[model samples]
Target: MTSPASTSSKKSSPLESSHRRVPTACTRCRKRRTKCSGTNPCRNCIQNASECIFQVEDIRKVTVLESFITSLKRRITELEEKVGKKQKGENGTQMPSQANPTEIKDGVRAPDTKQDAKCDDTRGLAKRDSTKFDIHLEASTSEAVYSAIFAIFSQSPSDPPSPVRSCSTDESLYNDVLLLVPSPGLAQLFASVTFHRFSDYVNNVFQFLNCGYLSLEPLALINQVASFCEFEGKWRYFAPDAFMAKCCMIVALGELYEPAYCVSPRNVRLEPPLVDKVPPGFAYFKQAVALLPAFIIEEDELGTQSVLVVEALTLAAIYLRVINKNIASSNFSLQALQMTINMNLHVAPLETSQEDRRLFWAAYSLNRTISLRVGQPLLLSAEEIATPMPSVNQAPSQKQELYKSEIHPCYIQLAIISEDICKTIYRRKCTTQANGVSSLPRFTLSMLNILSKLVRWADALPQNLKLDACLTSQGSYESHTELDRNRRFIYSLHANYCHCIFITTVPLLINLVQEQKQKGSKGSLDNPNVWKIIHMNFEACSISLRLYESLYRGKLITTYGFMDHDYLFSIGLGFIMGQLFDFSAYPVDISKYEFLKSLGKVFNILTNLLHNGNRIAHYKCMQLLDLIRLNPDIERESTKMAPVMVPAAVPVAIPPPVTVPIPHPNDFFLPFDDLLFAEPTVGMINDFYSTMSVDYYNLTEDDFVLFSDTFDMHV
Candidate 1:
């Protein structure tokens, strides 16, 4: 058969040719100019829920060939001229072409010299064009292949730079800090006193140190110790473990001298206050971190994976965060988390000792919280976490009643709930939002399930643990310190509880706002679903505001940090949204003016926070304050509004698992009814954001930009 094929080669039909277009990318990926996995409904198309049609990509070989030919034409002419010149030279005639002209007269051009120069120039141009064309072709082909290969790969957003770690590690920069920091003896005394003051939370510190559990080898650095011991008195008897001593002193200094803990520290001024003054805990915190690597080295020699190592790291991370050294804090947290994993703490047996279990849970909680706080993906997933729930009965030996009182268990419970929120809602929300995709978890059924879980968790709490019961239980005869501390504890518990409620209900409120705006009754009070969800959000905001108001009035809360900031900011945002509820527009009985006044309280607290070292909260507070001021009528109405009866705390209820009707995600838009909120346009949001300090959290506006488009605004 091969011998018989000695005839002329046959031409293949275009349709039957081997060089056919075979699309390896979906249409969605092609439209996005991104790589596709080449699978049916490739990853990108799947995530965006877009069509995945694959069409043949026409290769423009003819165009490239034509350009390639055009580049060669000038060079072909140069070659012909050279051939003629060589033939003339072969005839032995004194060819003018062979004589090298030193310089040409202005009017007289040297033909051979000029032609050779032209030939070189043309050849270079042709080579460059050819190389560039090749590069373009290769780039196109390689990009497609690589895009397909790495279709699902995306870079993780980096964690915020921790201020603590960002500080110069050069020992000399801290020379002054070392001096201002308390002498080890006096530091011990101060720590002892502060620990006594915060004795209730001392176990948290102890658990963090693993002090009682881990046996540290006899410390050999007695001279290192002696230089630090400025006060040589009987107080020397008060020295705890060297590392514990540092941690305790660091936290004590943070509580006693940091403006975050109290207003008094702010009054003790430093020049330029913003940059000249270091935060209160900086000195001790820096020293502690400087000592960490050595401590870890020694601890690791004892055993590479000790709980003390994890605890020391945890303490460092927490104190780093406290001193506004977030980068350092996050670094330490990462180390601690890795250490926890190395020790298999997450999968430790349920029957492990309370100490082990407590350490593990603390690590789990700390890592998860930091991850969320810094906008990082969780290092520990729930599925990977094989540890059991911390029970009140399994309380650690120290302060049994305090442990048994359910403080920790309740906190842990909320943490677990919060973890789910972080994983399912916040994680997805943030990722999708970052990618400019507005997809949200299907809310109706998912939210109901989450709310039910929260309800069950809260309902299981002891009567005294309830927010309503606890607030009512405080008596007038109680001392200010006692009352303040008690209330703060209650406030913290309730704030976290409300935070869960707030996060869970806020999405529903978003849905309602979209529904109302679409119905052309943006502020109409007729829709029960709108009213019900709004009521829930208001309650969450109200509870948080009440706590801050009490704290502000008493001047008791010194540290209004992340927890406080989150609650305050969310509540303020809710109030701005609340302004959209026009009570006068309908015969609705909701206290719209009183609600604004309550929001006014949140604004007032935020205004105070501006001076308290939180830049983000201050900016948000100013925005809300401006929003209120711009709406003169709302401001006036709020001022004249009488105190409404505090709506009875909405009783926590779990609806018998029933699915509710929900609209599609695309139906929602950020509600910016200028008339409803008394702003000229949505540009006000962007304006407020522009004036805010540029921090990691404040820098991204996408979170707020969720409602960018206008839906139906006439019902």
Candidate 2:
């Protein structure tokens, strides 16, 4: 394939070709090119898309018979000269007839030396006579096959270097390319690759996709699963796709099983913060999540398998309850959990039988509630060490072996899946966007998936629970120090999450800035990356939302488990936007109190919106943020201020569902355009991004290039 760089290179100008009049393909071939069973797709064309042309479009300098004879005779004479020269050099014998008169000179095959070995390297250097060419030939073409060939040739790294050039500086070209990348909206890319040439690939993969229950796979499904078990402190550079991988594995493996809850001393939360720890067996879980999607996804990225949301959440809850040291607060996860349930219920009731997917979600919600309700850590004490289990060698006794609930083959399957997801989510995250919405879920899910695996090990144990023979007499969890284990676990989890943020989020976000800046109004989904980033952005938000809901549902405040600092901060994003509505666009003029109050409102809404009725309100909250215009001084502020966080109370608490609806945030773009607020109740969020920092949001025309991405302005 052509490298993106090469495909953008300058093409030779028509003036550069001074000699070739209609330089083109062999006449014989052109006349019957379609019949020629040559090139990669020629045969395919003959049997299928029959118009696949084999002959090159442009006429060549030489005719078929003349070109062939010229080439062959030159080669023969060149060899004969070589043989004659060798004979003379070795035996002092001289060949007659001017050494076959085929030798070359001046690095060019002299017409007289066309058959000589001396001219071998220059055999094809002769100039062509183009003035005598015919002009009556037809202009035939190959569309599809050439398109594929163009893609390959354009992308191939081996191509000779050429000057780089944009097809046009008119900006429309850029907008067109930009439109081809992101996935912030509809599935524009669904037309190619797995769909081959249509959207059918997705239509074929999901029972729901074809039925219209969902369109364009939520893509966040995996992260939703990972969030429930999110134990990693905070994410670093994780990609949004990591979340999908993690969630998919859970649904594929543990969707229908009863979850086990056993806490491990070690756990990882979103990618990691700034710590390091000993690696655990469950780290493999992240790896698997990263890989599994390739098997099921038809697009370049994985498609949503919504079932993952239910299955993963259930397992993550069970694990958080059983594995890892206690956290400073359950508020982070609790708040998200409560909302997760409310959202699910609001979307569709949870009363359906176990056969229904909602049943799984309800079960998951139930499990988390039980885990968070606990006042202390299940596996770690206050000082932070692995808590001792009463069972043997971290194993069951001979009599306990007979019990099957935890040890069932299903549990083992879940464990295996968890291990894979943990590894997969983290591994691929290294390549995704960073700091942007696309990076969020990856950070969230890797941590959750890892925690889920460790926790499951305990739940899967036999109820009789006796130590394995090795640890029965000497091995014991009682010996480990809580503080030491906590430190180790935190460090490892921290390191990974940090990696996610730096490597994944930042790049993706930066790209988003460029993307949104370059977007045209003609079609949003046309750019796959845009759509991906947009979805990633919300999905990341969703992960945070779900965690807070879990904390709320479980009511596990003051417990050592997942912290809720992010929830407070995330909910605060809404606050900033709400504040923006009341304050001036000037950085200095924006009200600090308004900002604080808005943030608080966001948190309040987030906590309550988890209820069925408030989802529309929650949607409004997101839309409000999307409507926020940056303060003019935004660029002057340190990037540290970008996240705009408020210190969260430890053990964050959840509030009741919201019954009141919030007003839409003000817009800077054509404020009077009704379409902008037509769906004030709830609508997909749209954000303005820029590679270079800018205070403007909605529609300001400070950057001409930004508008150049304009479909409205460009044809």
Worst 10 residues of 2 by lDDT: 132-141
Can you give the lDDT of residue 538 in candidate 1?
72
Residues 1-715, model 2: lDDT tens digits: 8886345433535453232223343334356542233454443354555454335457667637734664675676667668778888998987654432323211112123232222223223444211110011010001111111122222331121111110111112122221232232112211111211112222222211001111112223324333443254222223434344343323322311111111111221112111121112122233332343343343333234334333343333332322221121133233323433433432343343222333323342232223222221122111221211112233434322221212222322332333243234323321223322122223333433343343343335343321221123222223122212112222222222222222122222322232322342211323222233323333333333322332222222111122222233333442332222222212222232234333333334232332212122333233223223223222122123334332221111223213222332111111112121111011111121121012211222332222222211000
lDDT values, one for every candidate: 0.45, 0.28
**With candidate 1 superimposed using the best TM-score fit, by how many Å does residue 672's alpha carbon deviate from the native?**
31
Cα TM-score per model: 0.53, 0.20
lDDT tens digits, residues 1-715, model 1? Answer: 5443223223535553333223577776766777566777776678788877888778876535633653464455455457657877798554443343312111111123453343334332222211000000011111111121111111211111111211221112233544555445434434444323333234323322212112221122233334444353112323334444344443544443332344321232221113234555454455555555764566546363365557667766666554444445567777877776777777888787666666666666666555554444557666777877556653434432343235656666666776776655443321133443322223223444555566666667676666556545653331122233444555666676666766655544543433343354535433333343456557666656665655554444454353465567667656655664444565555563355655655544554454455443433443343334444444555545433321121111312112211111111122212122221122432332232212312212342232222111110
* The candidate that achieves the highest lDDT relative to the unseen native structure: 1
Candidate 1 segments whose C-alpha is farther than 4 A from its true place: 1-276, 294-305, 323-331, 393-405, 428-441, 477-487, 508-530, 551-555, 560-562, 583-588, 609-617, 626-715
Candidate 2's C-alpha runs over 4 A off are 1-507, 514-525, 528-533, 536-540, 543-554, 566-715
- Total colliding residue pairs, candidate 2: 143
